[model samples]
Target: MKLSTVFYFTILFIFISSASYSQAILQKNISLDVNRQRLENVLEILSNKGDFYFSYNSSIVKKDSLVSFRASNKTVKEILTELFNNTYEFRESGNYIIIRKAPIRMTLVTQKGITEEKIYSVSGFVYDEQSGAAISEASIYEKKMLASALTNEDGFFKIKLKSSKTSTAELTVSKEFYEDTTIKIQPRFDQQLSITMMPVEIPENNTVIKPEDYLAPDSLQVPTDTTEQQLPVSNDSIKVQQTGVGRFLLSGKQKVQSLNLKNFFTTRPFQISLVPGVSTHGQLNSQVINNFSLNIFGGYTAGTNGFEIGGLFNIDQKDVKYFQAAGLFNSVGGEVKGFQVAGINNLVQDNVYGFQAAGINNFVTGKMHGFQAAGIYNHVSDSVKGFQVAGIGNFSKEKASGVQIAGVSNISNREMNGVQIAGVVNYAKKLKGLQIGLINIADTSAGYSIGLINIIIKGYHKLSFSANEVENVNAAFKTGNSKLYSILRAGVNLSDSNKVYSFGYGLGSELSLNKKKTLSINPELSCQYLYLGSWDYLNLLNRFDLNFNIKLGKYISLFGGPSYSVYVTDQDVAFGGYRFPVPPSHYNTTKFSHKVTEIQP
Candidate 1:
């Protein structure tokens, strides 16, 4: 009887242990009511009940339609099984569960049904699981190895990697709009694989994130000094728990910088680079810096102290000193002291002192002190001190105090203090110097401009009609600023055909003599072709005059001038072709040969 009792107790103990293990393995109970909720939302609700996370294929799972579910103190397994039924498969991996479509595994049969361990090439094809359609541009990589490949347009791919002793590789497949699929028993044999991926169903409430989320600090931020005991570590450091820049909901530009980044980067004496990734900054050859540097392709670092050269490009984080030359591009962050030259572009962040030359473009954000020349365009934001030249265009935002020459156009935004010469057009908000171009435009002409069309907002424009001693009715149109003006005049007689029809153009200016009476002086020079008959006649008249003007009102002015004339003609005519000599008429014999016509009207 005692033996029987012991046996009974042992049986009871085993039964209780098994029961306890089942209870412990059971998932937590959850109670919630969801009304037409998305599958993603339902998964989220399930995850919140315990320490479980769900990963599923979005394309296979329908998340757009609302799902209605009501469960009270139900196990998670029961709830999920009821929701998906036979439509998907769930595999638990630690705290995570991967959800995917029904699996269709294909196996290879070796000769004599014998499998051997050996290294071999691997190839594969990726396709959509639901439709069996080929998926292109899908990335495939071994989880633990550096072997990677991408699917071609026909969904074919190949990769080379070491064969695993276990004859399996963890292959991870991912593509745009598709859920990631991993093959646990990855093929290491000389065989092909057919991978199927489902499209991801995006959830409305899910946080958006790119595939590659760069959460590391920006490269521009300067490192903090750990040597200082008084420095606050909390303020200087940045904590990014996520693997991305997750601030996508921002409506406007957000300036986010590490506390230490606002300060300047540590200074360096010199550095060298043979290419972009190979440089002294990355090599850590010296703790401080060098005074001289050289490069074969490109260089990028904090700053330069002496001279630097590159075959392709040169990039500086802050400042550069002495000289720098590059075959392609040169970029400076803060300031430059000496000279910089590049084959393509020379860009300065803040200011430049000496000189800069580029094959394409040169730009200075702050100020230009010396000379800047470029083949295409040259621009200065603040001011220019010396000479500026460009093949196409030159621009100064604030002021220009030197000389500017361009093949196309020259523009000054605020004010000008020197000279600007362009082949096409030139413009200044306010001119305090000289401008020469085909078209010169200014708002206020405090200096001078010479061109075919000179427009000044505050200077002279006049249309005058007057009678002169030589011509009965003469009309002149004048336009310009205070510094210079152009005059175009024409005259004709009413009754006589050969009374002389003249057309002329000249340059002159008005000088203020008295402020009270608005008196001024006008000096002009003109050359006119007198038309006696047609193109068969040859007559040229050059005149130089000095006139005094008196302004009576806003629109009316009186002016007269004494002119010295030189007339040349091939033939002697009535009143259009010839003029008498400069000798006294009393001693001249040809005085009787000339006739003068007087004004009739």
Candidate 2:
């Protein structure tokens, strides 16, 4: 009796577990009542009450059609069957119920037994599963042999397949906006079949989330999918090639093929094309990633893995791996990993990892990790990690960590951590490096600037009044950091008999001598033109000084130092009302003076 009781309990437990595991969401009981509403709304109501979700294609079901139904304490399967008029099927996938059209039954028309010929033919007619209508332009292909054919207007297609050791071969039928269908058949026989295809379905909750949802309005963001993870060829994949240049270069048929064959891509060893739409691969060239591509005039392709050359221009919809060259221009919608050269321009919508050289310009919308050389302009929308050289100008919208050399100007909108060398102007929003140009501008700087005019918006600035041997009253303005500063100086002697005036430019460095910065040492060099009652003869004064600075008040300081001066003149007599400190020389002569400067407030 004990053994029998234990056996009975075990059996009961097994039965209950199996019942729970095998039960499907379709068998769930729910109550739904609608007088007249949209079919989509009705499905939503059912989903809410049933505590489940519905996944169906919008094309298969007329979402706007009026639907009226009543079901109380009925299974989901029964309700769906009655609601769709018994024309659809219900399936369970995870926690959601999938609604699809009922697949039409296929019948074998004719078949021939094994033949002597190695090549056998498979002829078929494709039909819609829901409406029982012929599906035209449906693609029928074999996987292993790469053999393919398309159905005509009458839905008739015939494809030849080579027989091998395998007894059965699989045939796949696909069309735009349709679910791919595959079937197995004996490879040795010539067969005729009737095939049916279903429409692809998307989850009702599938949505595309743009990057602006969490970013600033002026910031750039790429749109992404909010659904589950997917492979490279899913519907959620972005069409990066839908750009302004692509619209003008790529044909409409090529664009359509790119959209329809998102889940299909193959590799080819070589491809040749006279133009974009006219290629060796026909309209399917956009779906092929070739190892080698050559064009007589111009070409368009999905991508390049090795080498590609064109006579006029080259357009690639995807990434470039090794090398690409063109006569007029080269446009790539994806990342570039190798060398790219063009006669006119090189345009890359994504990042670049190698060198880009162009005759006219080089434009990259994403980050650049390599070098760029152009004749006119080089522009990077994001940051740069390498060098940029251009004849006219170079611009980086974000941070720049490398060197920028230009004939005209170099501008960085954000931080700069490297060097900028330009003939005219160099600008950085925040600088941590060095700048060499005629004019250098920075909002904030922790580095040095060597230019005729260095303007740091938030940097050091001070005006000082002092007296030197050359003139009685002197005034100077200094700007930049303690490490490096620029000075503009002018001095005038108020004596009515022998008035002297001077104007000059100089550079200085300040070093702190105490922890509190109360005492400091300053070294400066300046060259000035002295007006010693003469305008026809040259009167130049050059000086070097070592100053001791003592901070007195919050905005005041007392500074004095020893100076060395050299005076050169070529005037035999005074031309104006003033006379020279010493007798004027008939020939060029130098006079030296060494003295202590007078401290002034």
Candidate 3:
């Protein structure tokens, strides 16, 4: 077949698929069996059963909580109203349904010749371009107005605003991992727009494009391996039996093992009990460890090598390998080698080698080698070698490698060797990577710093004071170290009456003639503005100087050099007001006091 025919057939197939999806009617009854579960989960069940989709924010909707209810047969609208208790509002757009916060109640009084506030409702549905599935929790915001809304469980939104006479604004739709789209809205009246967004195509493996191949000429590009490998999102709990993800579970295993405290003796490879007190340790359970453990409420084991799950908390006295999950907290004394998920916090005294997720904090006193995400803070005393995300701050006392993303600050006391992104400040000593925040500081920077204030304490800085033939008592604040530096200088003719201001940038290098005597050479180019009332002119000077330093003490040095200067200025100083190598005949003994070759000594 021809390529044009293939393209036409593909378009037709997609259109038919989307049309059928939109035309799917909700005829099946929504059978509910919720048991105090989260509203988001309940909505998901309803959408799946009724052949629709739910769009909601993960932040606003909790999906992990258990719910309780049982209904054999019920309509979708009735079930949702009872589930939400009339708190959230719902809007329907074809097969999609939108959930939103209810607005304040208002009465409609439509009459002739009555100037009342005209309220207009903007409704729409956001969908995926390829799959045509509803994209839940997509941001729909006005570009020029302060009105915005998030699409509900079915990717539907209804934003009601007071109508204006010339109310035309730009509407922007954005979603995570998707390309953003924008449309103009002329909302003098009520309007509905169904927006389809294309997902962004990111290469799976690391791929890079050079800047010079994309940017303008006259600029050099230093290309590095910028394809950062992002770690996978940390799982909340360990998977069971390494099964395929996303399969619906009608019911899970519910087994209990509990015996009297006197029935057991030595440590067991696996222990299952109603609580930790009646485990294999019997009455002497304080020092016993287990390879695999499970507790209905909470557990206190000496150590764990395999998986362990608890309802409230899991306290391991020594070390914990493999997966360990708890409802409240998980604490380990020695080290954690695998994944650990907790509701409140995960604390390890020695080190953690795998992934860890916590509701509040993840603390490792020794070191951390893998991914970690916490609600408040992630603190590692020794070092961190992988990715870490924190709600508030990320602190590493020693060296840190890989990526760190924090809400407030990312601080490393010693060396840091990766990307650091934070809200306020990112500081490190001897940073060998990139730092992006409001303020970035490094003691010694061998990498890039991008922020408002990029302070490199040991990089390039100096101050020098010198005297030249044209200007006496010249003081310059030379920035950048001895190897390469720039200068901003000012001088005055204290011996005469010619006040001059010089400002310029310079490039220079410093080399060691020997270990005992350090010598430097500098080539400086400057523009000087000579002021003579309103009669002012400009001076451009190019000079190269070799400076030899003789150290007297740690804080003092003596330096001098031989200078070759080429002066160019639009001034009435030479013969015919413009001349190089001024005529010796034009010079009187008293008139030409400061000649061009006066520096020849």
Candidate 4:
């Protein structure tokens, strides 16, 4: 056959198959009236009305049992649901509706035991009821308290519980593809129990013509009901499981253990491990939550509830409570509640509720509610509510409500509500607090920035050209919030006899005097160096000015105010070898200062 012809035929086959499945008898709407009819007779009537056959094992349904119901234009599913009390499932095979019992839930197994002490300990082996074989990794838990245990390779498990008010507590055993079994036992003593779990059965074939023969003579068809149902993990959980320590440090067996117990957790008193796979709990290490864990080299487990100390590192599949310390690093997949200290690094994939200290770095992918201290870097992907201190840098992807201190830089991608103190640079998208650094920047700010250069992208900005007494032609640029700003200025004395060049930096603040913001008071302090043609001596000039600003237009202003000058210089010659003019020590100089300036910024 040609390729195109083959492709067309394949598409046609799929369409026909889908059509057959979509027209299955269970979905067809029907009107039925029956008053306490025998179950078998009702099935026959339904089969005839839907033009299909009912198939099942004779013992599966009580044929002689009386069922009474009336359905008006209801789907076969609805009718059958009322008949069987929703305890059966139906599947279509050709024209047959194959009936089977739904998987049983919470089968109770009760046993009487002698009560002895205040501590209750239970140990057991789980087995398959049909084959009389051991079932591994079956979860046995007390649902009310979330105390659980998992069967190991030998179908063995042990769990400890405290005495409760009731004489008996129920423990549920569950595994994939098996019926849930609940067992009731004395909660005040130690006992051993054996549990047998039944596997779910699919409805058997009972038709004259099999589905495989009807579809294709040579191929066998597997029923869709027999496929395993896999529980899905969330995207965030998957990201946490794919961390560097989870991938490289955990053994294949440990990973498998984590996957098997994704829906359950079991508590243990204590555990010891030489490495990830070799532990006191053997291959079931990652499935256990322990009170105390001592790792000779390192260890991987589900969680820590009390205290954990490792010689090298510790990797937890879930939350860590109390205290956890390691020689090299510590990685947790869930929340941290207490203190976590490490020699090198500490990584928490979720929130941190306590303190974290690391030699090199500390990272929290979720919110941080306490403190973090690191030698080099600290990062929190979410908001921070406490303090962060680092030798090099600290970063928060969201808002920071506390304090951030670093040697080099501090960054908050969102708002900074407290303070940021850094040696070099500090940045916040929106600043509602204070920032002290060499260079401070913000998109918009209602707070103060103390630095040599402060830039608020959406706040205050001004450029001015003015003629002052000492420097004839001067230009200055101001940037920051209206409350506080930094200025960079340069000037040149154009006079032939006393030619001088000056560059300076200053700090200023503006205060509005009226509702229209047309008039304002500006107080500025600046220092300048006069280059009088010689680099041989010091020439420093300091000035303080108070300027009264009046709005002239939308983008223009007029300003003239009194100024104070203080000069300290040792230079005797100007740049061209002209005698440099030195002002007296206690002199005050003032002249009319005018400019094409921007005001009310």
Each model's lDDT comes to 0.66, 0.79, 0.63, 0.80
RMSD of model 4, in Å? Answer: 15.4
- Candidate 1 lDDT tens digits, 437-495: 88888888888888766777777788877655455677877777755877778876554
Q: List the residue pairs that clash in candidate 1.
A: 36-67, 37-67, 58-199, 58-200, 58-201, 59-199, 59-200
The true-structure Cα RMSD of candidate 1 reads 17.7
**Model 3 agreement with the true structure over 149-179: per-residue lDDT tens digits:** 6678898987766666774666767665667
Worst 10 residues of 1 by lDDT: 249-258
**Worst lDDT window (10 residues) for model 4?**
592-601
Q: What lDDT does candidate 3 reach at residue 428?
A: 89
Going through the candidates in the order shown, the clash numbers are 7, 0, 15, 3
Q: Write the per-residue lDDT of candidate 2 for residues 460-527, one digit (tens) a residue.
A: 78899998665779898888777888888998977777688889888888899999888999998887
lDDT tens string, model 4, 1-601?
Answer: 6999999999999999887775667889988777666666667667767777777755456666766767899999888888886657777776778777664342333343656666778887888775556898777777555456678989898887778889678887877656787788877867788888886543442323233322221122223233333333333342345888778877554554455456666788999999987887765677688999999999988899999999999988899999999999999988999999999999999999999999999999999999999999999999999999999999999999999999999999999999999999999999999999999999999999988889999998999888776667989999999899999999897877777788999989999999999999999999888787877877777888899999888889998798776666765544564335644223443322221111111
lDDT score at residue 6, model 2, on the 0-100 scale: 100
How many angstroms is residue 447 displaced in model 4 relative to the true structure, after the best TM-score fit?
0.6
Q: lDDT score, residue 489, model 1? A: 84
Candidate 4 similarity to native, TM-score: 0.65
Q: How would the candidate models be sorted by lDDT, starting from the highest?
A: 4, 2, 1, 3
